[model samples]
Target: MAENGALLRVENLVKSFDGLRAVNNCTLEVRKGCLTGLIGPNGAGKTTLFNLITGFLKPTSGRIHFNGERIDGLPPHLTFRKGIVRTFQVPRELKSMTVLENLMLVPSDQAGERIWNPWLFGFRVSRQERQIYDKALQILEFVDLQHLRDEYASSLSSGQKKLLELARTLMCDPQLILLDEPGAGVNPALMKRLVERLELLCHELGITFFVIEHDMDLITRLCNPVIVMSNGEVIAEGSPEEIKGDERVLEAYLGGQYLAGT
Candidate 1:
């Protein structure tokens, strides 16, 4: 059902704000079942491109295809129903809700959500609620946040909140997940665990990922055929080894920090 084995494709994508092109004639693809990485220096239009793909922003001109269907102008909720979900650089959890509740809220159009349906179909509503609760618990366990399930999301540390964000995405049963800076503020220990879970999701669960991060270490560890963006267009795509040795990549953004890390 995929086009050229690609789950998502963007062709000649462009977005401009008051004549300032934030994403200029960009083109890329996220192949099915691969953990793809998107990297660039600050202001390379990574986040802006994500906004366009996820339907937070409409493109000035371009085509976006998912599962071979044109979906360039769908709203966020509609795009989500197409099984593409995204997480933010800053985790957006409900501060007043427990971690479990946060995951429970992700599924769309629950039978229990309608007041009259819940009253009329009490048994069905209860059964669905129980199933959702169990699934939420399993996801929390996978992200190593099961112990914190009952705690308010506000009580979680920065790393734990990231884990919670990922768990919420899983509840949507997504095929392609765009992660924006999953390693941004996470501690090294938590980051390792998060990486392990992401790998398992890609390899075992057959989920695909498109990630944006400044952490080259995490990018190299988890992504292959990395895509580099500069001034709003893709400039390179290759494995981490190839990318590291690429003169263009080094000169564009990896000049100092990447070499220092190595």
Candidate 2:
């Protein structure tokens, strides 16, 4: 297990595509129970770093530490089994599945998963399914989507789909959640709701979040100790307030006018 108190840590992490380094010798730590933010301009390699950490892409060099063990090149499913889960910029749901079923499908190693077990051990499988269903209902209500539990995932609005996605992640009881962009297409009202739910999850449930976001306003309002990446490398790390005024950050992405206005 990862010692000290960092839930996730990357040291000298690097990735390259056709000799073009996308994440170059980057190093960062996400402490346990933190709602940390990662933000940068387009092509800043933020997503690539997320990919590396989540095992979507293996690092060309360096190590990734999660909960004190080296999880550098583990497959995505294995990484998830180890309690590091990631959601994409675009929510991916089983469109034909009900919201409740979608949530039920995330917790791996379910007794109902084995093709033979469900048949030979029907009662056991049924009991397990009931447990998963009950858990799914609770998660749906936690994310305020219980009313839509029976609705097809495709029927949900974009914001509701985002909520569904967040609900599904809770099924695994992950230690760290890598959110690509929770506020990407959400409207102000829904974004506020999402932020509030996440804050409650962080402070109350103590779920750790390592987020990648572009909305500076959302970042400033919701995050602390934001990490900024530029040109495939981390350029700065500090509080949201400090980042808003940093000359380098303003020059790289947020222009002086925008910084001044904020």
lDDT of each: 0.90, 0.88
Highest TM-score scorer = 1
Candidate 2, after superposition: displacement of residue 44 in Å?
A: 0.6
Say what the RMSD of model 2 is: 1.5
How many steric overlaps are in each model, in order?
Answer: 0, 3
Per-residue lDDT tens digits for candidate 1, residues 1-262, read: 4568999999999999998888999989999999999998889899999999999999999999999999898989999999999998888899999999999988587898887997799999999999999999999999999999889999999888888888999997899999999998899999999999999999999999999988889998999979998888888899988877778877787464653564
- The TM-score values for the models, in the order shown, are 0.97, 0.95
Candidate 1 Cα outliers beyond 4 Å, as residue runs: 254-260
| Candidate 2 pairs with clashing backbones | 1-68, 2-67, 2-68
